[model samples]
Target: MKELAYLNKFFFKYKWQLLPGVLFVIISNFFAVLPAQIIRIAFDLVNENIALYRLFNGFDKQSLILDIFGSSLLLFGGLVIVIALIRGLFLFFMRQTIILTSRHIEFDLKNEIYNQYQKLSLAFYRRNNTGDLMNRVTEDVSRVRMYVGPAIMYTINTSVLFVLIIIAMLSVNVKLALYCLAPLPLLAITIYYVNSIINHKSEKIQRRLSTLSSFVQETFSGIRVVKSYVRENNIRDGFAKESEAYKSESLDLVKVQAFFFPTMLLMVGLSTIITIYIGGLQVMNGKISSGNIAEFIVYVNQLTFPVTSLGWVTSLVQRAAASQKRINQFLKTKPEIINPNPNPLKVNGAISFQNVSFTYPDTGIKALKNVSFEIKEGELLAIIGRTGSGKSTIANLVMRMYDVDEGEIKIDHTNIKYLNLEDYRSQTGFVPQEVFLFSDTIARNIAFGQDQLDMQKVEKAAKDAAVYKNIIAFDKKFETFIGERGITLSGGQKQRVSIARAIIKSPQILIFDDCLSAVDTKTEEEILNSLGNVMKGKTSILIAHRVSTIKNADKIIVLDNGEIVEHGTHHLLMNKKGVYFELYEKQLLEEQQELS
Candidate 1:
């Protein structure tokens, strides 16, 4: 019950659907108890030599006996059949309404979980694995639905039937009713121990299953690497270990259930034995009639069956509680990044970083320290540095993937924090060093951000990125489907496709984060030449390692060890004989050696 507290809002939202379903459950249980009463009446008729027709009308004994073989027996059989049919009808409605409501609730919950995932920050995803999250949305959600459906239905049915059957037994004989209920306290005590063990084991089983799922997902996603390294046997051994742990936990849960269910049945059987032994003696002593003893036995069986099945119902409830707790913990996490400004000024891509310092969460090392730079509107600024020199960090900051720890980033002389995040991001196009493409047609990938595809713009952007010739070389042309993560495309082709995607947006600012590293020198030159006209009067930031790539920029900044070491154009940096000069000299020697 404590585990189910999180579902209170869902219950309120779907009350209309659940209310009628509950009423049907009560009605169904009432009819289900009727057959026992009807059987008792038949037993009384036989014991007293009384005809059923005599009860309806005051007829003589002889005529009543004569009619027993005629219409009286038929009336008794027909009454039983009618009651059985009505009970079946109520049972159908009860299950249909409740099960459907549970399905609707499941649908709503899955969507809500997905929406939460979208709102969560990238740092949250970095901390969790894909398989664990997938299991929560699929398997855990199904478990929760069981509580709203079968658990709720059976709980109501058992409770209502228990009260009704107890009252019915009391009417037949009060002493027997008290005797039959005596074992209930012991049964409840046993169930408490069983439920506690089950709840603990069920939570363990779910977590172990999640661990197994994560292992499988990660293994398959990195299958190429595993095969390349000849680590198939090692991976198989790891998977087997996870699988064995899952199996052991599942069997433990099964063992608990095996002991629990039969214990409940034993309690029920004990109660039935007591009823028969005591009720028979009472009948022989002439305190109660034989028919009354039979009625008491039938009511006792009805009560005991539900009690015996309570173990199974409690298992479902414990599982749902465990699953709901996991889900609630995920939903309760708040994303660090959010839209702070209700109304924000528009951006024109004039970026300024003033005394900015940043450190990634969970890593004490600073990524950037006191980094300061500015790019005026329509200026072409190029950043060059060795690996881990905060080149990409600058791009990440400009894109607002993370906020600065100190100082502020401004666009168009207004703080970026005071600008609408979505609107500001819309005006900029980013092409990361590692390009990612969806499994879709080439044209769709190029026009990824647009609501509607403009084939003309798509083709023009492809042409500008210098990939149009290769695209038409395919049999399907732009309509060809690429494999997952663009597996079918070469590195250069994927990079060009990413460039096309950015170019088609016609953004006020364009960022090329070493995106041309994979292409040949000739292709790189062609792309730069094609992009010259597109970049005119637009703020462009190029982060590159090759000196040839950024030598022509209006301004070049060289970074080393999280700090800017040099700032100047290509010729000025060469004459200054600094870090940029050394890099240029090394690259020039490599090219000259290649020519020789």
Candidate 2:
């Protein structure tokens, strides 16, 4: 209930709907309870007329009594039907208002969670799995909705019925009514203890469901890997194991319910039995009429559903408390990176790293150390490094993917952190080593960076990235579906398409980190030639391992084990015969050997 308190704002938000729904519950219940009193009156009337008919022996007098008696019974029967119809109508209204409002709340809650997920930093995503996050937004919210709709409705109905039935019973005969209600206090105490056990079991079941969902998501996403490795049997066996665990947890909860519902029914049956025994004894003693006993029985039976649902509502609220706690915890998380400035600023893209150092937070690996360099606007600076030499770390810092742990990164002579994160990222074009494109058409994928798709810009960007020829060769050309993650295309084609998508924005700062690793040297030269023209007025940072790729740059920096080993023009580095010269000579020899 403490966790469920968070939903009070939503209840208040839709108060008008909830208020009417509650009214409908009360009114319908009032009509339903009235029928029991009618039944009592009809029974008493019949009982009275039985003696009156016995007293009138002659035809005329007895016939008169019979006619009146028959007519009165019919009238009472008609009245009960009308009351039932009226109650049914109100029940319809109850569902219309309350159930519909729950759906609306569901929509708002899902959107709220999705928006929060979008606003969270990448570090937050690193900490949580996609399945757990998805389950919280979807399955957990669904459980909570059961509390908001059916649980709440049943609770209100039960409470109203209890009040009406108890008052009516006491007014008729206090002693019998008290005896009938003797079992309820024990029933309630049982529910209280059962509720704690159910709460604990429900949370365990939900966590198991999250684990199951994660396994399925990961399996589907990596199905190709599984098939290629011939691990289909292994995956199937794993799924079976998870499914069995999920089934076991579900059965454990079900077992508790199996124990719980019967107990409630047994208590209900006991109350009914007590009503019959006590009421019969009172009637034998001439304290109350048989009709009173009939009415008491109706009230007890009417209580049957409400009493059963009391347990159900308690169960629902408990599960909902568990789920809402998870949701509230997620909502409370503040993103590590936030937009520092409300106002958008100009981006000339003069990016500089001053005494910069960074460590990957997840792995705690030092990827950069006190490295300093500056790339002016409209200058092309290339970084060459061995694998794990922090070349990509510089690219990541320039793009603001991760804030540096030490020292300052500035753009246009302002600290990068001070810029609006949205504005800064919007002005930059990044092509990471691994390419990811949506399961969309070629032109649409190229134009995915913006809201509006322009085919002309798409074509131009595709031509510049040198993927236009490959796209045209397809049957539908730009309209061809690239498949998931662009798996329909070859590796080099995917890389080029990713480049096209990046350049389609005409960004101020362009960072390409090993984006050309998939293509041959010949295709690389053509793409680089096109990029030279496209990047004429923009700041470009090219990160690569091939010397041929960066030899023509105005400046090149070589990184070795997270430190700068050389920084100079290509000519100066070659003349110095340092690490840069060694790599250049080695690659050149390999190419020459392959050519021969």
Candidate 3:
């Protein structure tokens, strides 16, 4: 419940509905308890009149007694029916106000959690799996809703009804009232201990479900990899193992819940038994009338349901508390990456890295050591490096996907950290080595950079990336529906489509990080030729392992171990005969042998 207190704001938000709902519960219980009092008066009326009818002992006296009985039955029975109808009407309003408000709260809570997910940095995602994230927003929120809706409603209904019944019972016979309610204290003590067990088991069950969900999500996402390796049986076995663990935990929770209703029923039974024995003795001793005994029995019966439902309501609150704790923890996470500048210093794309160094946060690998470079406006800078030589790291840094661990990066000599992150990213075009596209029409994917689709711009970008021919070859052309990650297209086609997506942005800063690796040398040349026109007034950085891809660059930097080993134009680097020369010679020989 302490964790659930985080939702106090929502109660305040919808207080109007809840206040009226509480009033309805009170009104409904008033109508409900009034009928028992009416039954008591009718019983006493008939019992007192029986002696009068017997005293006269005549046919006319019998007729008068019959009339009296008939009138009492009609009046009291009709009142009982009318009261029930009124109670039912208020109950309907209760659900409409309270239950509907709970749904509204659910909607607000889910959106808050989703917004928090979007606000968190990539580092948060790296720490938590997609399954746990999904569960907090979906399953956990549902559990909390149970507390907001049914649990709160029943608790209110029970408390009001119980108080009314107790007041009525004491007005009849104080001694009898105290005796009948003696078992309730013991019932309360028992529930106090049982709730702790339920809470513990519920937490374990939720944790296990998160694990099971993660395993399933990962398995389905990589089904292709499993099939390719012919490991379907192994995957099945792994799923079975995880499923069994989930089942065992769920059963443990169910076992605890299984004891609740019966225990509640046993307590109800004890109260009923006490009411009969004590109430009957009071009537015989002339301490209360027979009608009073009947009224006490009816009051005990009225209490049966509200008392029994306590078991269910308690469990809901406990489970909701556990769930809200998880959701609160998720919401409380502070992102490592936040915008330092709300109003950005406008960028003109002249970028500089003065004595920059960086390390990968997740892997703890030092990716760069005192590395530096400069790219002025309208200049093309190419970086050629082997795999794992921090090639992509530079592209990431330029996009500000991460900040440097040490040293300074600047745009037009202004600190890069001072730029508004959203504005900076919006002005940059980036295509990573691994291409990704949504499951959507090719036209929409190409125009994803803009809020509205522009077919003319889409076609132009496709031509610039040299993917227009492949797109039109399909039966649906630009309207083609690609599968997830654009799986319907070939590797080279996916890369080219990704490039089209970037080109359509028309950004001031463009980064192509080994994106041309999948396409053939001829297509690569075609794209580079078109890009030469597009890059006329923009700062561009190209990361590649192939010397031929970057040979015509205005300048090239060669990296071997997270540091620049050589840098110059293609000819100068070749003349130097260093790492760049060795790589170029090896690739050139491989090409000649293939041609021969």
Give the number of the best model, judged by lDDT: 2
The candidate that achieves the highest TM-score relative to the unseen native structure: 2
Off by over 4 Å in 2: none
Give the per-residue lDDT of model 3 (tens digit) for 384-481: 98998888988988877778999989987888778888888888899998898999999999888889999999999999999999999999999999
Model 2, C-alpha of 425: deviation from truth (Å): 1.4
- Please report, as a residue range, the 10-residue window in candidate 2 with the lowest summed lDDT: 119-128
Query: In candidate 3, which residue pairs clash?
Result: none
Q: Could you tell me every candidate's TM-score relative to the true structure?
A: 0.93, 0.97, 0.95
lDDT of 1: 0.87
The 10-residue segment of model 3 with minimum total lDDT is 52-61
lDDT for predicted candidate 2 compared with the true structure: 0.91
Residue-by-residue lDDT tens digits, candidate 2, 1-596: 88888888999999999999999999999999999999999999999999999989776789989999999999999999999999999999999999999999888888999999988876688778988999999999999999999999999899999999999999989999999999999998999899999899889888888999999999887888999999999999999999999899889878888888889889889988998999999999999989988999999999989888887888898898888888998998987777779897778989889999999887889999999998889899999989999999898888777889999999999999999888888889999987899999988988989889999899999999999999999999999998877879999999999899999999999999999999999999999999988899999999998998988888899999999999999999999999999999999999999999
